[model samples]
Target: MFDADWPHRLHSAEQVRALDAQIIAAGTPGFALMQRAAAACWRALRKQFGEVGALTVLAGSGNNAGDGYLIALLAQQAGWQVQLYWLSEPAGLRGDAQLAVQAAQAAGVAMQAFDQQAEANGVLVDALLGTGLSGEVRAPYRAAIEWLNQQTNPCLAVDIPSGLCADSGAVLGAAVQADITVTFIGLKLGLFTGAGPEYVGTLVFADLQAGETAQTAPSVAQVLTSDTVPRLPPRSAACHKGQLGHVLIVGGDLGMGGAVLLAAEAALRLGAGMVSVATRAEHVAPLLARLPEVMVKAMRSAADLQPLLARASVVVLGPGLGQSAWGISLASAVAASDVAQVWDADALNLLAAGTLRAPQAPWLITPHPGEAARLLAISSAAVQAGRPQALARLCGRYPATVLLKGVGSLLAEQGSAVSCCVHGHPAMAGPGLGDVLSGAVAALWAQGLSALEALQLAVWLHARAGEQLGAQGRGLAASDLIAVMRRLLEEHAPCRT
Candidate 1:
C-alpha cells in the first residue's frame, strides 16, 4: 500500500487484467483478490464515516458488486445495520461476485433488488461500474447514479466513480460524485484530472496485494507531485550571467506591448541570463518603461529580428501577437529559425492556420484546450473528452514538445511519453498565466534541458508556484505570482557541489 505506487497499481482495464493474471500465476486465488478488495472498501468506509452503525451499499452485477457485497458482510460482522440494494438482479451476478453474494447471504446481510421505495438513511457505498465502462452509462445504472446523487448522505466510490473514463477522466454520462474515493490496484489517470478531482473527493488508494512488478507495465505518464519534480541545475560562484543563456521574446503587436513585456519579465525573473524583446517599434518604449532591465529591440519586419533570433539561445513567441499580416509574417520567420522556442497564443493559432511550420530546433507549445482543438481541427468538446489522446495527437503532428494547459496541464513530446502537472490552484484561471509559463519554459530550455525535460519542469514549476501563492487565498492574478516563481527557481536551482 505504498501511497506513491497506488496510481500505477490501479491501471487501465487491460493493465488491471494483466496484473490480475500475474498475481493468479503467482498462485493467489481470484476469490482472494475479491476478498482483499472488499476489505479495503470496508476499511475506507469506516475510516471516512467513523463507525456509523447503519449503511446502504449500492451493488451492480460485476466485480464492483462483489466488493459491495463483501463490504456488507464486514459491516454485519461489526454489528451494524446494513442494506445491500442490488440495482441488477442478484442472481445475474456471476464469478467471484456471485460467491460474494452467497457469502453475504450466509452472513445474514440483508439484501434486496432495486426497490423504488428505498431511501438511503446512512452512508452510501457506490459499487456500480468500475474501469470497464465505455461510452454513455445505460439504463437503470444511469437512473441509479442520478438517484444516488440526490441522496443527502455522503458517498464512497469503489475503484473510480462509475462512468468516468479510466484514461481521460471524462464523464461517460451520469457519474457518481463521491465524498471519498477508494481506488484499488492502479491509480487510473482519470482519477486525478478532468472531472476526476471533483467527483473523486478525498482520494485513497489500496493495492489489494499488487506489487511493484505491476508498476512496470505500459503508461503514457503519471501524475506530477512535488516529490516528482527535479532540482534545477546548480550554479557556482564562478558562474556569470553569460553562462545562463539569453532568451529573445518575439511578439507584442501594436497596442499589445503588455504581452511580450510579460514574457520578457517572466524570463528574467526565472533566471535567464539576459531577456530581450523584439516587437513593434511602438512597444519598445512601453516595455522599457515597465521592465527597465529588459533589452527591447524595435523590429520593422522579420529580417530586422533575424540577428537577434540568431543570438538568442531560446525564443518565446506568440504572446500578444495578433493575427494580422505583420504578426503572421513575423511568426513565419520565427518558425523558420533554428532557435529553440516556447510557442504560445497567436503563434499557435498561426501554426494551426498552416502559415507556420514546426520548428527544426527544440520547441514547446503551450495551448489551452481551445487552442489545442484548433490545432487538431476538432471541437473543444472533443479535445476535452480525450485529453491524453489530444495531447498525443499534438505531439505526433509536431515534432516538438507540448504543454496542454488545463486543470492538469499535460506535457508530452512526439518521441517520448506524456507527463501531467497535478499541482497548481484554481486561482491560476486568471489571465497571463500562459505567458508566464511560456517564459519559464523558455528559461529552462536556455538553461540546457532537452525539449521534453524542459516542458515537464517548466509546467511543474509554474503550477507549483501558483499552488504556493494560492495557499493563502484565491483570486491569484498572474502578476501576483512573479515573486514565488523567482523564489522557487532560486531555492531549487542546483547548488554547486
Candidate 2:
C-alpha cells in the first residue's frame, strides 16, 4: 500500500499521459479506463455530499465528459436530482465517450445541450476539460467557465477544473474555482504550482489501482514534501561544534546591514556549527550585540572577504546586498570563490544586471516571482503562469539548483527534476522569510547535502515552519520560524551512518 500519510502532490500533464499509457498496457481497455474514471468520480461525489443533493455536471467532448456522464448516472440511481450540460452534441462523442453517453441515457440521466440560460446555482462537477488542453481557451467555453466561477455553491471538479493548464496550473483564460478536485491516474503538476493551488481546491488523487506501474511513469515534475526534505545528521552528545559546518553570510551594505545579520542569526539557529557575517564596517557593533555567537567582520572590500570566505563551508550571498559598487565588488569576489553558496535578494539583482557571471561551484538561487522574471528576462505574469517551466528554464540557464518562491514554491535543477513545496501558510506573507530560507539552505549545504538536496529541503522546512506559526492565525513574523526550525531540525534530522 502507498504511504497514505503523505500529501498527494501535484503532477504534470506528461505524467498523467504516461499513467494513461500504463493503464492501457496493463490490459485495461481505453473504454474500460473511462468507466473506471467515471466510477471514481461517482465515489468522490458520494463521499463529498452523500445522496440527498442536486448536482450539475458540466461536460464536453472528450473522455472527461464520459466521466461526467457516469457521475450523473450514479447520482440519478441514488435518487438525487442530476443534470448534465453537454458543450458539444451528445452524438458527436466518439468511442468510449460515446459509450458513456449511451450508458447514461439507458439509466435515465437528464442531459441537455449548453444554453446561456442554464442555472449554475447548484454543486458543480466540472468535467468540461481535462489535462489534454494546451494554448488558450476560446469563446463559449470561456463564457461557461466564467459563469461557473460566479456560482455561489461549492464546486467539485473532475480531474482538473476547466481552463487550468494541467501541466502548470495556469488559467488558459479562465478556470473553474473548485472547492475540491478528484483526479485519477497520475497527479497533474499544474495542479500544485502557479495558479494550480488556487484553482484546484482541496485535491484528492486515485491511482486507479495502478500501484508500482502508476509510479513507473516518468514524472514531468515533482512536489516537495517530507519525502524530499533533506535530513540533517542527528546530533549526538559526543558531537562537537566542529562536526557541524560553518556558514558565512556576505552582504548588508551600509543601510542594509540588518538583512545579512538576520541571515547569519538564522544560520546559527538552524544548527550551523558556526555563523559569520562579512559586511560593511559600520554594521559590526550592532550585529555583535544582537547575536554574540555570530562572527562579525568589518570588510573594506572583496580582498577583506577573501580570508573569511576561505574558512567558510557555505556562503550565503545577497540578503540586502545593494547594487552599489561595494555590493558589486563583494559579489564578484563571491563569484570567484569555490564555496557552495545560496544566492538571494540583492545578489540576484546584481546577477540580473550582468555584473556577475555564473559561480565556480554549486549554488542555489532563491527568487520570488519578480526576481525570477528579472533573471529569466520574462514578464512576472509569465513566470507566475508557468512556474514549473520557468523553474526548469532557470535551472538550465544557470546550471544551479533554483527555488522559485511564490504561492506553491518550486525547486528545480538541470539533469535532475523539478519539485514543488506545498507547505506554506499565507501568514508567511511578511518580509524576511526569504532570508531565513537562504540561511537554512546554506546551512544544509555546509553540512554536506548536494545543492539540489539543500534547496528542496530548505523549501520544505520553511513551509513547515510557516504552517506551524500560522496555526495561531495570520500576520506571523519571520522570527517566529526560528523556534520551529530548531525543533524540526532536531526531529527530522537523519541518523548518520
Candidate 3:
C-alpha cells in the first residue's frame, strides 16, 4: 500500500539540485543539510540492519561522498569499526564535502584508498556517484561498483545507487545493487522507472527538512498513488445502464478468443454500464459462455463493426487482434470512429506499421516496451533505456494519452506531468494483462473520466491489484486481476456515494 505522506512529486536530478540550492540560499547552511542527510541515512541504516557493528564506506569526490564520510564518522563515534575507501581523492573535495572529510578526520575514522584487494568489512555504504553523472561511469568507480555487487555483504546506497542515471534510470555502465537505498531531498523520477527498480532494493526517503523548499520547486513527474489519483464520481440513485455509457472491446482472432474475453470481462467488472465484444464469429460462443453480460457480435469485417462502434462511448482496441486482414479492417474502422478509445496489442502494432493513422478521438495507448519501440522506430533496448523520454515522445507524437507498461508503468499526456505507478509485482508478468488494462482504461473513460484520468486510475488499479494478488507467488494469470480491481475500485470509489 502507498503511504499518503510519501511525496507524490518526482523530480529530475537538476531539479533536485536546484531545490537543494534553494534550501541553502534560504538560510540553511549546506554543511548542515549534509549533516542532516547523513543523520537520516544513519538512522535508517540502524533501523534496517540492527546495529551492525562494522561499516565499510566507499567515498568519491562529490557531495555524495560527503554523506559517506559523515556516516563513517557517525559509525566510528558509536565505537563501531569503520573502514572508509576513497575512490576519488579526498584532498580535492570542496565546500560541504571538504568539511565532512575534515570532521571525519577529527573524529579519527580510518580512511584508505579503494583497491580491488580491499575486502568489504561489513555493511557496504555506496556513495561513489550522485545524480550529477551524465555519461558512462569511469575506471576505478566502475571496478568498485562491480566489486560491490560481487560481495555478499549487505549494502546501503546514499542518495541513489552508484551508476544509475537520476534522470533516465539508465545504468551508465554498472550500478550498485544495494539492500537499502536512502534517498534525500526529492524523489528522483529514475528511482521508480526504467532500470532503477532492479538496483534499488528498499527505498527510503528523507527531505533533510527541506519539504517546504521542494514544494515550490518544479518537478518533472508525479507518482500515482491512491491519494494522488482521481476517484470515480458517485452514481445517482436512479442511474440507468444507458446513462453510464457502453464500452466496446474489439479483437480476438481465431485462436486468441481468451484475450478478448478477458478484456470484455474486465470492462464489465470495472463498472462499465454496458459491455460489448466485436470479435471473430468463432469466438462469440466461448465469450458468451464465459461472460454473458457482454453483448457479443461476430465481426466479419469493418462493415460488421459499424453498428457496435456506433453505440459504444469508449472502444478498447486490439486484444489478440492479429495482423490479419480482418483485424486491420476493424482497426481502420475504429480509428475513423469519434468514440474515445484505449489502444493495445495489435492496434498499436498496426499504428507502428503505418497501417492505421493516429486516432483523432480522445484516446489512450497502452504499449509494452516492444510495442513502444515499434511505435518509436527504435530498439526495445532504447525504449527501456530512457522510458521517460520515450513516453514523452510518444505523448508528443500522438494526440492520445500514453501509458508505457513495464516495471514502473508511466502514463503521460501532452500538457501534464508524467505519472508513474510503482505498485506492480514481478509475478504479474504474463499474457492478457495488457488486455485487462485496456478494458480498465475504456471502462473508466466510459464512466466520465477524461482519457488521462482514466489511464491514471486504470494503471494504478491494475498495478495495485497485481501487487495484492502477486504476493501469493508466481503463475499469476491475467484474469486474476479483474475481481481484485473491481474490489479495489469500489473501495476507492463507492457507487452509492
Candidate 4:
C-alpha cells in the first residue's frame, strides 16, 4: 500500500526555502542540490516527452535559470540540439545562475538574448521565473512569458512555471503554460489552488530527499487526496437508526425546493440514520415525492423550525435559501439553535448581512469566494489574492469551522490547521453543488465525526464524487453526486454482513 500521509503534506515557498537551507547546513552543497533539481527535471522531461531532438530554454536571472541551463546542458550532451534564450542579460547573471551559464558554456551549450526574432519550439523549458514573486509580472519578463506561452511545443517548468505565484497560485499578469511541471522540495500549496492548476500541467514532484531527510518546517495546510480519505468503523448487524444520527435540512423556500431535496437526499444517501426537511410548506409534497425516506415538514414560523432543530442531531441551514421573509424566518431560528449545523448559501449571505446570527453550537459555514468576501467585508478578488489570510480571518470572526469553496477548497476550525481538498472537478461549478456539500457535511457531523474530521472526509467524498461524475462530461447536474456518494460511503464504511 502507498503511504497515505506523505502526499497530503504541502509547504509554502518560504518553508521549502527553509528546508533547502536545512539541507545545505547539513553539509550538502547548494550547487549539488541545483544539480539534483536539474537531473530530476531531465528525467521527468524524458518521461513526458520521449526522444525529442531539439530543445529550447527560456532562462531568467534566478536559481530557476540555473536549473534550466543545466537541463540544456543535459540535453546538449545527450546529442540533442539545444537553444537558450536569455530572458535576462546572460553577462550580469550571478550566484547559481552564473555558475549554470558558465557550466552550460563549458558543455558547448549556446545562449542568446530573447527578441522578436526568437522562435521557441521542440519541447520548451520554462525557467523564466521561480518562486517568491511579490508583484505583478513586469513587462520584459511578461513579453518573454507571452512568447513562451504561444509555443505549441510540450513545455516543462523547471521548479514551478514562471509567473505562477508559488504561494497563492495567482498567475502574475502572465504565466507559462506547460505540458508538465516538475516541482522540487515540497509540493507547493499554490499549485493546487487558484490559477496554479491551469498553468501547472500534470504535476510531478521530486522531493530530492526532502520528504524524509530535509527538515521541513510546519506547513500551513494539509492536502486531501484519495489515500487520506478517512473512513468510519464498520457497522454491526445489530446497528439501528437510533445508533446513527438524524439530520435536518432547513432550506428550499417555495421556488427552491429542489436544492433542499438534493441536500436531504445526499444526507440520506451518505448514511444519515434519518433525514428531515423543514422547508416551505409548498415544498413538502415534492420533497416527499422525490425522496420518500425524508420526513418533510412545513416550516413557516420559528415555532415550526425549532422543533425540527431540537430533534435533529445535525442541522444544515441553507441550500435554496433566499434572502426573503420565509428564508429569513427559518434561518434566524436555525442561527439561534445550538445543534451542530452547516450554514450555507443564503444562510451565509444572511449571516454576512447580520440578519442571521452566528451559531452558538458546533457549526460550520460553507462559503464560496463571493460569500467569503462578504463575510470578511473584502473584495472577492482580494479574497482570492490572499485566501489563507481570508480563511484565518473567517475562523477568527465566526467561531465556527469555515469551508471556503473554490479550486482548492479549504476547511478550518479554531485551534486546528487548515486542510485543502484538491480533488474537486470544474464541472461542479453549478448552482446546487454547495447545497449537496452542506448536506453531506451535516450527515457526517450527525454521525459523530468532529467538525474537522467530518469536514475532511465529507469534503473529500463530495469532491471525489463530483470528479467521478464529472468525467461523464459537461452539464454535470448536482444530482449526479447521489449514487456516487452512496457507493463511496459503502466502500469506505460497509456493514459487516
Candidate 5:
C-alpha cells in the first residue's frame, strides 16, 4: 500500500513553474508562497534531524535560493546559530528573491560569500541550483555542490538536489547528495526515475497549498501506487479453470532452464488457469518435478511449438531463449502466431538483432536498459541518461505495450501517459527476476486484462513483492518473490466474492 495523499501525477519542471505562476496569478502573493515553502523546508529539516540548533544555508540567485534565505531567517528567529553562504551575488537577485534576502539581512542572519574553504556546520542546506538547470553544472555552483557533498553533516536539499536534472534525472556533472529533499507544488518526474533515486535521499512533498491550481495542472506521467494500479475483480463461485485463460511460456535453452521455469511458476501462481512450458527437452523433467500442474513439453524444433501456441491464450516469449539456431527458430515461430505475447530476455535480444519480426498480436516487451539499448540502437548509457525518452522511442517503434524495466520501471503504450513504478528495492538486483515479471504480465493478460492494464498491474505487483521481501537485506533469490506476489495479488484481488 502507498500514501493516498502523495501526489500520483508527475510533472516536468516547466509544468511545475507554470503551476506556480497560476497559483500566484490566482491571488496567492509570490512572497507568501515563498514563505510557505521556507516554513515547510524548515519543518522537514527539524523533523529529519531533530533540533540541531544550528543551520547552514547555501543560496544562489534563483527563487530556490529565496527559500533558503527565508529558512535562515526562520532558524535565526528560533534562536539557532545560522550561517548563510551566497554562491551568487545578492545584488543580482530580483522580485521575491530580493525581498527574501532583505528580510534575512534585516533579521540579522549573517551572510557571507561562498568559497572553496567554507566549512559546513550543523545541517548543510543545498539551495544553489533548482529546476531551471538544462546544461551541465558550471563554475562556482558546481564547486558549491561538490563542497556540500563532501560534508559529513546532515544535509537538506531545497526543492530539488542541486545539479540533478529536474526533467530527466540526469546528474548535471555533479549533484548534491542530500540526506533529505523538500520539494514543493507538484512532484517532479525526475525525482523517481534514473539517477534521481540515487541522489534524492528521502523526499518530502509540500504543495505550498497550491490546492486547485495544482490539481488542474497537466502532468507528463503518473506514478504507480496502491490507489492508481489496476486490480482484478473477484471471480464468481461458478468459475472454473477453463474460464481462466491458458499461458504458454516458450524458452529455456541448453543451460538456462531455470528462466522458463521461473516464468511458468509465476504464471501458474498468479492465477493463470493452465500454464504450459515449451522449453528444452532437458528442462522438461526438472520443470514437471517442480511444477507438475504445468503442461511441460520438450521442443526439438520450432515445429514442436505450433500446437502449444495454437492452444494458448497468451504466450510469454524469451525467458532463456538463446541466440542459437534452436532459439531463433522458436522465436520466429512465436512471432508468426496471433496469440497475445510477453517478450523478454533472449527473445528481446533476438528481436533487437532482427532475427524475428515484431509480433502482430497484442504483446508486451519487458527490457532492461541493456536489452532496451539493443532494441533502440543506442548505448545503454544513453538509455539511462534519458529513460523516459527511450521508453517513448520504444513505444514508437513497436505496436505492443512497452515496459522498460529497471529501478523505477516505466510502462507505456501508443498515445498513453507513461506509468512509473517506484516501489522496488535494491535487493531485487539478481537474475530470474525479469523472467518472473514476464510471466506475471502474461498471466494478467491471459486473465482478460487489456495489455496496458495487465502491464500496469503486474509491474506494481512485482515491485511491491520485491520491496516486501527486500527488507531481509541481501541474498534475495528471484524465486523468493513468487509466493509473496501470489499472496499480494490475492489480497488486492480476491479469488471468490
Candidate 6:
C-alpha cells in the first residue's frame, strides 16, 4: 500500500550530501535546509511523545546535533522538562549547527555536558551522529551510544540511527537503537537494508519540499512497493489456456523429489497454463499422487529430459538438485537448454563450482546469502556486510539477472539499477521460500513478462504473501506463500478468471 510518488529512490550518504549541495546551489541556503530538517524532526518527536513527561537530547557537534537543539527548544516552549546533553562543546560548532546552538540558547534552552551517571530518563532524542558515519564508533561517542542503548526509555533518532553506515547499513562499532527514526530529504539506502532495519525501528521520512527535480544524479536503487509491482494487466475474457506459457521443473534427484514438486506446484498455482516435472524415476508416482495436474516424468538421463524441456516455455532448475552424478548430468543438460530459465538452490552451487556453463537462454538466478557468498568466493558475513557490492559483482560475473535474497531482497540486471523489496516478513526466512520464488518467477516469465519483470513481480509477490501469512505467527512454511501469492496476483494483476 505504498504511495506511488513517495520518494522510493534510495540515496547513498555521499549522494545525499551531493543532493543537499545541489539544493543549496539552486537558491535555498544551507541553513534553510538545516532549519527544515530540524522542524521535521521536532514535529515527529512531538507526535511520537505527546504524553511523555521528560525529554533528553543527546547532541553532537555536527548538523545532526543541530537537530537535537531545535527539538529541545520545541520541547521547552511546550513547558516540558528537558535535559540537553552535548557530547562535544557547542561553542566549537561551525556552519548551520553553530546557528542552531545559538538559537536554542537565545530561547533559554540550557545545554549540559555529557555525564554517564546522569538521570537519563524520558524520551531520548539521538542526534549524536548522522548518515556521515562510515566506520566503527570511536571514543566518547561509543560510550554514549552504549549507555543510551542500556536505557529503557523510548528514543527518537534524527535522520538515521547514529553510527549506522548510510550506504551499506553496517553498524559502526555501535549504533543507537531508537524506537522511532525521522529521516529527511533523500532516503538513505542503509535505512532499509543490512543492520539498518534492526536499528531503525519505526521510520518516518520527510522530503522537506526538496521537490521532484533532482539537483544531482539520481540514485542507483529504488524500493519495489505497490507502486513498482511489476505485473500484467487484467486478462481479456477471450484469453485461453494456450495463451499462458508452459513451465517445466528440473531437478529433485533421488530422495529429494519434494523440492522439484514444490517448484512445479508453485508454477501451476501462479497461473502457468501447463506444468511438467523432470526428476528421478521413483519420484513420478508420488508427484502424480500429490499434484496430478503436473505432468510427471522419470528422467534417468539428459535424453529423458529434452522432450519435456523442448515443450516448456520456461525452465525452473535446481531445487533439491544434489551433487551426485545423476544431478550433475541433469544440471549440465538444463544449463544448455534453449528456453528461458530460473536457476536456484543447487543449480547455483553447481554454477559456483564451475561444473556447468551459464544458461544458453536469458536467465535469472535466485541465491540466498550463502549461495551468493559461495558464488562470489567470499564469506556470507561479507555478503551481508555489503549487499549492493555483492550484487554488482554477481551481475558483472554472471550473465543471468540476479536476485540476492535476504532481509531486503535485491534484484538487478546487468545494466539496471538494483531494485530492493522491503515488504517481506521475518517468518519468510524459513525453508522452501527460495524454491517457491524461483517457480513464481519462471511462471511469470513463461506468461510473457521479461526476465527482469518476472523477477521483480515474483520476488514482491512471494515476500508480500509471506508478510500476510506471517501475521498468523511464526510457523510460516515455504508452501504457505503459494496460495497467498496466487490470490494476490489475481487481485493485483489478474489473469482472466
**Model 4 per-residue lDDT tens digits across residues 240-347:** 998789999988876999989989988988888999998888988888888999999998677887777778899988888888898898888887777888888888
Task: After the best TM-score superposition of candidate 5, give how far the Cα of residue 437 lies from its true spot, in angstroms.
Answer: 0.5
TM-score of each: 0.95, 0.94, 0.98, 0.96, 0.99, 0.96
Q: Give each model's clash number.
A: 8, 6, 0, 0, 0, 2
Model 6, 160-266: lDDT tens per residue? 98888888787887999989998878888888888888899888888877885453358968898867778776678887867899999998888898889889889
Better of 1 and 4 by TM-score: 4
Write model 2 residue lDDT over 162-207, tens digit each, in one string.
Answer: 8999887788988889988888887777777788888888777777
In the predicted model 2, the residue pairs found to clash are 11-187, 11-188, 11-189, 12-189, 168-190, 169-190
lDDT of 5 by residue, 1-497 (tens): 22468889999999999999999988999999999999999999989999899999899988999999999999999999999999889878999999999999999999999998886789999888889999999998998998998889999999999999887788889999988899999999888888998888999999999888888789988999877888888898888898789999998999999999999999999999999999899999999999999999999998899999999999999989889999998999999999998999888898888888998888889899999999999999899889999999999998889999887788999999999998899999999999999999999998989989999999999999999999999999999999999999888888886
User: Which has the higher TM-score value, candidate number 1 or candidate number 6?
Assistant: 6
Task: Put down candidate 1 lDDT per residue, 1-497, tens digits, no spaces.
Answer: 12553453224566766777788778988889989988888888888899789889989988889989998899999999999898888888888889999999999998887656787968899999988898899988888888888899999998889888888889998899899888877677777667777788888887787776466766657666546555667877798878888999989889888878778888888888999998999988888899999999998888888889878999998998999988888888988888888899999998888878888877788889999999999998898788889998998888878888887677777766567766778778787888888888888778777767667777777888898888878778777677787787676664465
lDDT of 4: 0.84
Any idea what lDDT model 3 has?
0.91
Model 5 poorest ten-residue lDDT run: 1-10
10 residues in a row with least lDDT, candidate 4: 1-10
lDDT per residue for candidate 3 within 301-341, as digits (tens), equals: 89999999989999999998999999999999999999888
Residue 107 miss distance in model 6 (angstroms): 2.7
